[model samples]
Target: MTGSVTLVEVGPRDGLQACKHPIATAARIGLIERLRKAGVKRMEVGSFVSPKHVPRMADTGEVMDAVGSRAEPGDMVLIANARGLEQVIAHGARTIAVFTAASDAFAQKNIGCTIAASLERFAPLVETARAAGVAVRGYISTITDCPYSGEVAPEAVVPVARSLMEMGCGEISLGETLGRATPCRIAAVIEAVAAHVPIEALAAHFHDTYGMGVANVWEAVRLGVRTVDAAVGGLGGCPFAPGATGNVASEDIVYLLHGQGIETGIDLDGLLDAAAYCGDTMGIAPVSRVFKARRG
Candidate 1:
């Protein structure tokens, strides 16, 4: 609908964070490296969450070391708090994303903190990062539905988004973490958030659980959102979101956008190859409908 959008690849972070089995550190780094070679300028390389709670991301430090030393411009991590920020500082991470859910219950369950507490903790991290010449990003989870809290109101998402910006996050990513958001619901949340947060500073993170991720992406684009978060080979799921699917596939987003004459600056063939490779390394098949249909 407008200029090019920044598609932030989240395969290495959200994609791997929810997996039950831990992928080899080398394989995980391989995924990030391949994505970089495929011309993905921005990525959520990994997270600094507790390894015991999420064994899949246990190799956080190692993965950071691997991706950090080789990171090109614009690569980053989904940090949890000030400690996480500190951990990635040595990796030379300039862009860090702090996440919170729109539903209070989900926030408590996910991070053991109330919504306000989570934001309060992140405020200092954001200040410290910005003071030291780093950029901060924010993620608002459960924009549509929450497993623990059921349906989430569009109004509920706005204040959190606003709060995150007040905390100094450069952008706010609205996540349909449970994958229950339809195009209409997505538009509703966007409309609500627009009243309080500028559309230009907003992004969408949709999952394909009900085959609506792409459609939701179209809705987001129509609403003037310039950033969209995706993952390769559809490789992520949320532990708290029932029937949650992996993220909207990067290859699919790239294909649809490029076909529509939008410039995403990604190499389609290279993206496909990287998706296939990551799938292979993770011992899974590519779940993107576009990826499978194209091969046929």
Candidate 2:
């Protein structure tokens, strides 16, 4: 494992998008500022998707403005086509994310396309972003298990990751989107992908649905993944996957990393404070183990 880990906070976008309550725009920006205070240099501040499809992220542009100068502007929103890319660039974004799934069933369900078609769709957007001088990150969902399709093969994920890498994506984040991945399964997926992609070129996005988020994180680290993605206070879920939970919490991941003497450059106490602020204002009990322990 590398000596340091880069934790990309996704609370402002992924964490808040599925929320039933309308998190105020100021509150959302406040989360971004607070995470910055906790030493988060990169975050997915918001998305530029259609409001009709994702009402919660309708104010992503505003959140970006509010986060102005507090942190470097990065991308986490799903860009389906050129229109989405244009909106992201118009919002002053220099980085963007395009996602594809390893499972055909989930791909079709989520984006109305087969895995091949989805990658084809992202091809133009990826080319456009690269030409426009923007950095592009690739995301692969269902790296382990898909809610719709049982056990996704590691072979199924390798080519998609390779395609993203060949398409000029600087980084590819592998998603155990349902968060049900065990250490063995997580290791298997990483092991396969690492064979095709460099360890430095890969990251992991593990969910907490089965309460195995941190364990899988540790396994990823052991397998030499230098980057991890988390949401502040564990505030995200897949709308399509019923009963699945949030992203692994930022505070919790920091606590574990600090305990293991891993350097994340994050202030754990400050991150806890931010988690508290999110929980209190959002009216949801933080799903983070460390945050709950610290609060209690």
Candidate 3:
């Protein structure tokens, strides 16, 4: 708990992707710059996917160009297939992330494929990324509860995480996409996945829909997860998962970790400024407790 944790800010990508109104590309760039200025070394800048499917991320190339050297070593873009990988590589992305899921139902809904099929599709992509000297990270969603399929088993996540690890992913993030899982379930899934994948190579991504985001994160940290995915202002939810809410706010995570005498290498006040900028751009108030409390 005392050691430094790496918080991968997902605000620019995951946070703004599901917005009802189109977020201007300039606003996205501003958010990313503000986050970097706040000492967020690792972040999900954007994704390389079809504009038709995810129009918000269509300007990823432009964002990358504008960010230029400001993008830190661990900054990453999500890639869904070979095409996405090619585009991100062309954009000079140093790191890329691929995603699958523990639930076949959610996979079919989100990516139009089964769990095994998705892995097969990513095989060549991962190999190609490795050869190109780009770090690869993998994500497994619906670690405990699936919107399409209810009550996923912890064991269901093991093989998916292990497969990503065996395929050369430096890190695998386990996602509680539904935001309904409590600390007990979070511990269960992490423990199960850690058995097959190295504990050091796992990250936690949680939603705050049910107000369990911070508590779930505390559980993951207790279980030895050092990397966490969060968004500024708690922006973003799973478009495919009905009723799902935004991710755990970055400000809240920094407060929790710092309060516990843990290091996150993030400045809370700077992060709040970034969050406020994000909220203003989107015309919505930040829902993070710490942000609201501090502003008051």
Candidate 4:
């Protein structure tokens, strides 16, 4: 854990998407700018999906338009289909992420399609992204446990990761959507998928519902995962997955990594400021341990 790790902030998109109240577009932009100022080089600022389905993301195009020029190469918008991809491209997105799940039931519940059908859908999207010179990042949710299907076999994730990589995704983020995964389960899934896909191309996305998010991240990094997805102030949850909680906080990740002699290149103080801003704006205190411990 001594080397550098890439932390992709997801607060603006995934974090705010699950909020009960609507987050203003300006507030989202403010959060992204604060994260960038705190040295967050990679993040998911928005997504291109139907506003009716995800009203929180209705202003995705506007968010991208405001920040696209200043966004980093790794900054991206989530796209569910060809239409979403087309919209993101028009907004001048340099990178985009597509998501599916290892469990068919979870995939159907989350994206309204089967696992196979999801891949079939992403194939052309990946191809189009390649032609458009936009980098693609693929996400596989419920890698450890699925709310609809229960525990998922690690082997089930291999083909999905391979398909995403084969379809030209530069990185594959394995998501522990339920937040019930321990290091053992995390290792099992990562080991299974890493055997088929390069470990370097894998990223870890975890939730803190059962309080294992940081521990799971530790296991993933120990197993050679460099890219990690987190949200500032521990903001995020699966809308489709019942009882799930927010993502592992970016503040917690920085604290853990910096303590381990690992470099994340994020300023802890600045990150706290950003987290405070988010919590204040939303009228909720940050749930991150570091934020509570330091700011309290």
TM-score of each: 0.95, 0.96, 0.98, 0.98
Determine which window of 10 residues in candidate 4 has minimal summed lDDT. 65-74
Clashing pairs in 3: none
Once superposed on the true structure, which residue ranges of model 1 sit more than 4 Å away at CA? 69-71
Scored by Cα lDDT, where does model 1 land? Answer: 0.85
RMSD of each: 1.5, 1.6, 1.1, 1.0
Summarize candidate 3's per-residue lDDT along 85-126 as a digit string, tens digits. Answer: 888888888899998999999999999999999999998999
Each prediction's Cα lDDT score? 0.85, 0.84, 0.91, 0.91
lDDT of 4 by residue, 1-296 (tens): 47999999998888988788988888888888899899999989999887888899999888877776334676788999889988978888888999999999999988999999999999999999999989999999999899987899999999999999999999999999999988999999999999999999999999999999999999999999999999999998888999999999999999999999999999999999999998778765789999999996
What shift in Å separates residue 165 of candidate 2 from its native position after superposition?
0.8
Report the CA-based lDDT of candidate 3 relative to the real structure: 0.91
Clashing pairs in 4: none
Residue 26 shift from truth in candidate 2, angstroms: 0.9
Candidate 4 off by > 4 Å? 69-71
Per-residue lDDT of 170 in model 3: 94
